[model samples]
Target: MDSWVDGQPADSLSLKDRGLAYGDGLFETIAVHDGQPVLLDRHLVRLADGCLRLAIAADIQLVRQELLSYAAAMGEGVLKLILTRGDGLRGYAPDPTAPGRRILQGNPAAAYPAVNAEQGIRLFPCSTRLSHQPLLAGLKHLNRLEQVLARAEWQDSEHAEGLMLDQAGRVIEGVFSNLFLLRDGVLLTPDLKRCGVAGVMRAEILFQAESLAIPTQIADISLEQLQWADEVFVCNSVYGVWPVRAYAALSWPVGPLTRKLQTIARALLDA
Candidate 1:
């Protein structure tokens, strides 16, 4: 019930798969509710971009149909879609004949305590700074050792998430989510031109903000700027949005901006 590989029921992938051997693949973590995959078109758009960048042949129609089918079967949950360069001959060279593989898996929808959404969650300032790679920026590729290391920085229940900074000490994003800082009635997220995943929920919020006339910008944001922010929220497609109540020595009361966006985000998820 948890997995399907290449449209067939299977748990194990080939050992020679490029995704495992070289992290040569892209992925999307989507939220499914009542048989609908939220922001599906947006997810597919991103997946296509990744495929183009990696020069991987993408069967978009097949991938989209399969995701919908998988999500419907699961009813409501989280869906992890992985598309790899398929099996390859032993070496660093990519196999020219490889026809990509699709691996879909599911998890029960996570239940965030009401307080975290109603109030906010604490954040740990991770010591692991993300490396800069402009060419690879914003793609949800399989190379996640950086995030894995950052998440390992803490083991405390008090911190619900870890805030990661880039090499320049600019706040890039949360370990597993995107971050937005509301400052002086403006919405701002760290620009992913240099690094960080351009999350699907982040895209939705940006579009909604534009329609609502809520000023939004994307640029390099420093820790001091976030410390002085009126509100800060972290988001991902699976979790929607979570306000940041406390990070390091700073504390913020859940503000109007985060609430306003959450309303739209929830509606978009159900739409």
Candidate 2:
């Protein structure tokens, strides 16, 4: 399928676009099923929040309409929406009133081995660490050099994902997913206050946990804490949930809680 720039079909963008120049933008990777975008409202809420935080002037209503139209045409696939601060001059200072540029690219659904979710996956201990940036911690912004570097640390099929830690040696998340662990029946996830992308799936899982009456905690996680976990799993809006069986030498089983949440996540994604 052809990509759309704003509301029109285009394969090219302006050379001076700020998203290309300075990475001044936000993006959302949405799942489309049966010609409808899954978690559409949640994705938009995150996009709106990012625009607000970055002070990028974007037309949310127009974006929503474009997404609906794009997803309807896509039918079944993934839709990536990029909102940039239009084009800009050669500088760091941004034009506060510039309307954001919207680009929609469609792709087929992600292809991951079923074993990663069924039997569990091995987590590569990434050497790359996330930097501390409180202002941009959870926005799913365009600047992703850190993740790019981290992902490049692995190049083998032996590992399904990589575990990323912050500079302070606190466990943060995966290269492209949010992580969660269970201990003593309490679900715990690393706090993204200082860094890490607050993934849409992570938010949904938290809400689901609450509705299920499961206790969940968001805190600074340590390597020591991960070693003590009864069950560990990673999640993203695309893959849903993947149970982490091993990270380096530490290992964990796909516990009952992880399986329970995995079922719920599967239902949500497949819906």
Candidate 3:
């Protein structure tokens, strides 16, 4: 693993950093292959948009350059970029003039077991309900207590992911990825306006669907509707895409739509 910090080694972070105090920060986990960052521009766009939504001062170009440099050094791995509200006095209100901090870290890419991606993964429906906070709905910010709690609900190693529903029992997304279901030959993903991270891979798949003239819909999904879908898959930039073979007792095949999306995703990574 390799890392770079904006401050002194001992001054890793001050106790006054607002990010630690209030989760006032954002992060992006990117995939690096053959010394190149995958979907670099897309990740930057999302990161910049997140900073804007949080009112954080983040220069997209600077962040991109730093990420490229770090990724190049790491060669092939996972690149993590963390932007946080820099040091501040003890208070709930942020210091308007405080400088922000950026930390870039790189590590060997997480080795996803090939059989899981090839065959499929099992999912357990978590009892944790995602809270609807439109203000923080789509941004990948630091306040991830909901995901943490949801993930903790299941300790079974057989379960690769947990499906989380909204407070009203509407299917939202997975703990760390976007959810997409194939129903009656159409692709459907939950609307992110209510909750969940609007993942970069989700956006890429949506764009590819439009380019390929594949029918896609963004709507409010319910568990009952999901149970009847032809297939299910979860996606995130780091993990690419993986079909969901089983969610509780409900089962699905790795259908044509999933293969089509996977092909497109592979092409994007190759590009």
Which is the leading candidate under TM-score?
2
The total number of steric clashes, by the backbone 3 Å criterion, in model 2 comes to: 0
In model 2, the runs with Cα more than 4 Å from the true position are none
Output candidate 3 Cα RMSD: 1.8
Best by lDDT: 2
**Residue-level lDDT for 253 in candidate 1:** 84
Q: What does candidate 3's lDDT look like per residue over 1-271, in tens digits?
A: 5467662223266687878999998888898888889988888898888887887776777778888877777788788888888777777776555447888877877877886678888887899999999998989999999999999998977888899999999999999889999888788999989889999999999888778887899999988999999989998888778899999889999988887888778666655
Candidate 3: where is the Cα deviation over 4 Å?
A: 7-11, 97-99
- Where model 1 places Cα greater than 4 Å from the true spot, the runs are none
- TM-score, per-candidate, Cα-based: 0.97, 0.99, 0.94
Which residue pairs of candidate 1 clash?
A: none
Q: Provide the lDDT at 191 for model 3.
A: 95
lDDT, candidate 2, equals: 0.95
In candidate 3, which residue pairs clash?
none
Quality of model 1 by C-alpha lDDT: 0.91
lDDT of 1 by residue, 199-227 (tens): 99999999999999999999999989999
